[model samples]
Target chain A: MAEFWMSEIIKECARQRISLAEYIIRGECENSGSTREQVIEKMGKMLDVMSSAANGGLEAPIRSNSGLTGGAAYQYHQYIGQGSSLLGTVMSSAVEMALSCSEVNAAMGRIVACPTAGSCGIVPAAVLSVGVSHQKSREDMVMALFVATGVGMVIGEHATLAGADGGCQAECGAAASMAAAAVVNLMGGSDEQALHGAAIALKNMLGLVCDPVCGLVEIPCIKRNAIGASTALVSADMALAGVQSYIPFDEVVTAMYAIGKQLPAELRETGRGGLAVTKTGLAMYETLFGTPMSL
Target chain B: MNATYMTGSYSVFDITGPIMVGPSSSHTAGAARLGKIARILAHNSVKKVTFQLFGSFAQTYKGHGTDKALLAGILGLNPWDLGLRDAFSLAEKQNVEYIFEPVTKPTQQGWENYHPNTVRFLITSENGEVFDIVGCSLGGGKVRIISLNGILVNFTGESPILVTRHYDGPGIIAAITSILYQDKVNIGNMRVDRKRHSTTADMYLELDSDVTERVVEEIQKIPGMLNVILLQRINEDQSLNNIE
Candidate 1:
């Protein structure tokens, strides 16, 4: 049988008078043939990894193996410590945490792939920053993660998560959408509101291409994660204020997939289009590998 | 929804996790998984290995740390292991020799048909046993073993499996199935491959659950069975250890 759809999940939760997280927990238990405790324990371990990766880069300037991207997260952390962030504490911390996690990923430190490694920073940054600032307990954060997982599964099932296949709209866009849902859930928004948040986040990122400079995840990938966190927070806030998406979440995901398919191969992580082929981008590639960019 | 393209059920962890060390899940993490499975199939006795990388794997393997991750896995390190960064040194310390040969030209006969992110492992054991395994990283840290020892086969590394090399003859398949049925073990999928005019063939059985040592021994006793190896699912719970 096919897995349940987002609409089915929402209807089931409504019919059973249960929260979205509880419904997801039940679905996971049935689908994977694991006990409730086993699923929770696995999620708990994932949360632990996310927590560390969110902080791993801020504590030190960990450079990528290519020596291209590093120390930006640390610098941003120091800037936040100086209280100079234009965004307030919670949002600013989300951006910093997102940068840190992406940097750590570029350094090859361990991370939980929230949809994907390139987009890994967004979900943890959004959930942890908002949850911790509001004094939500660890269980509350884990529940928020379940909400994110639910949204990610729907998008991953219906659309795509790989940049090579669906561009950055699928990776960073899916991540921001998932993070928005988690943030909305953590703030006590209803399931509908959480989905609306996901819709808004994804709608904002439609058509974003996956053109990594030099074919590394270091260049635009790291900074794009920071922007994704900010977008998630804003989308969550909008959702909490009862703002509605013009299109449904599932429809939005389908649109994203269609647009991704329309993108040429050069823009889909090929490093031959968009910002990857800028004069400086090519120079960086040539300098790093002692060869001009090909293919 | 288009159910035609969507067939499998994904766990929450499958959507959110496989907690790993990475810059790219398909390149770094999935490549490591393929190497680890090859190591397990070779009984962890890899003395030398040659990774023939194709297409994307050949072009960007070094940038994505696919090379190090592959070696680390061959040296018995999981994708989440911190030692992945030092995989080259670790392989050297373990006396495991490795080479990365990038097959960039499509003119190489039969090579153009491989996946863009494919790697063929030519692994030699300490006792002189050799294995040829070809695998492809199917994005999101998922992998599939596409070939073994020049015999075409297909299986994702996500399942527990029994792999056998035996002389192709009557009653061999029935004998193996009877043993599994007696042990109450169900085979989820099965594939038998043999080259034309070849007496030796390979059988791959993807199992619903891991088989016991006793069952393996029973299968080993069957006449014409050259070798039987049980490969547990490589992406088990232990690989998700929290980062230190």
Candidate 2:
């Protein structure tokens, strides 16, 4: 129950020439995990983040400083006004993240699949933000990824990072949390801030769901990462500025799971509840997908 | 069966290989790391080498031009050398002999910890000296020297000096450092590590100085001594270093 020291993790990795994935995966396997299980678990948690963000996130309920609501593009415009070009870059990259996987699914062979097809952008978007914003060298990128692996391990332990278990709140919310923690660490966020960022992200996205229009990860999953990233930056900033979450990280994860189960199956990513159930959503689904979607 | 690779955004992972270049990425970049690892094992003597590889590496060693890589790495080539492209064919350029073996069997249990696509080089020199190195390519053109002999040594080329390990007692560090001290070799920092609570061990010396062939041979003679690091810096006059 000792606190995980990012510096020690990095130093250990430096003394060894293994990637964070290999290092953590090796540790997990040593502790009795199959390779397939580890990658799948990571995917599942990330998908939750995307799926939740596609549904309404707490950021929506919070006061938006900008009133630039037009279409999907308008959300991007909001991210741009949030001050940091890095935020804008992350949001744009999130779009690219979704498109890349779609292309990869369409083209390149996958080592493995993403959490769902929808939220594939979250991890990659967050990873790129570190390289771009912090100007991490190639080796540093590798090291940061290792640090990220550790943070993700903690998240996977603390929360249900999957939409199936905790709706998108645990899923995309957790992914953004992991991503935020990593970017903050790379950009010199203290260990306290990094963990705090993750906690705050979970607190904000407590009861999200996976309601893709017409049951696809494409329509909303991509945009969700961008918005989630914006919130991640805000949460990380708050944590960095000495705003601390009173709830322990483990408790937040447990609460997320409880809240997720309370959600009807319709909201658990079946695209059967919430937005998918609304008349307007149904109309949009019929127009975009087909009539008689239920049949 | 699992070739896992994670290419972070904006990063390049050139796993593609079997080129006409003197040293293929898998062979040259990967091989030098392998050879350097070999030097780390066997107390860094590496009197001779018997290398084993699986599948693709075994099949296309020649065409992929891994020979140049093995040759230079066996000769201990610089990682960034353009000439390394020809290492497979040009190993004769270094006057070192190598015999390759293809391992058709799946890795032994617990060996699962190592890479599936691995090259285990068993090396020795003219004096009946010996070394063994385990090498793996972890995508993005990055290579890892997993183990030396039986001891695990991590080599990232972060420091320029090589490492050697043997029965650890008095004068080991002194024997190595004294030579460097005598040669005016500057020690930047060292990553000397021991496993199993300090029984047999390896010490990675990142010297501001360099190692010569003569130094390696002399270090080979010490009692209970294993190997000496085989690091020879290429003279600093290559155009490739300044590439845009």
Classified by CAPRI criteria, candidate 2 counts as incorrect
TM-score of decoy 2: 0.41
> Clashes in each model (backbone N, CA, C under 3 Å)?
0, 38
Cα shift from native, residue A105, model 2 (Å) = 7.0
Pick the DockQ winner.
Answer: 1
Model 2: DockQ vs. true structure = 0.01
Runs off by more than 4 Å, candidate 2 = A1-116, A287-291, B1-244
- Number of the top lDDT candidate: 1
- Interface RMSD for candidate number 1? 4.1
Q: What fraction of correct interface contacts does each candidate retain?
A: 0.63, 0.00
**What does candidate 2's lDDT look like per residue over B110-193, in tens digits?**
333476346788777657866666777543234767666565655554335566877878777778777667777787777767
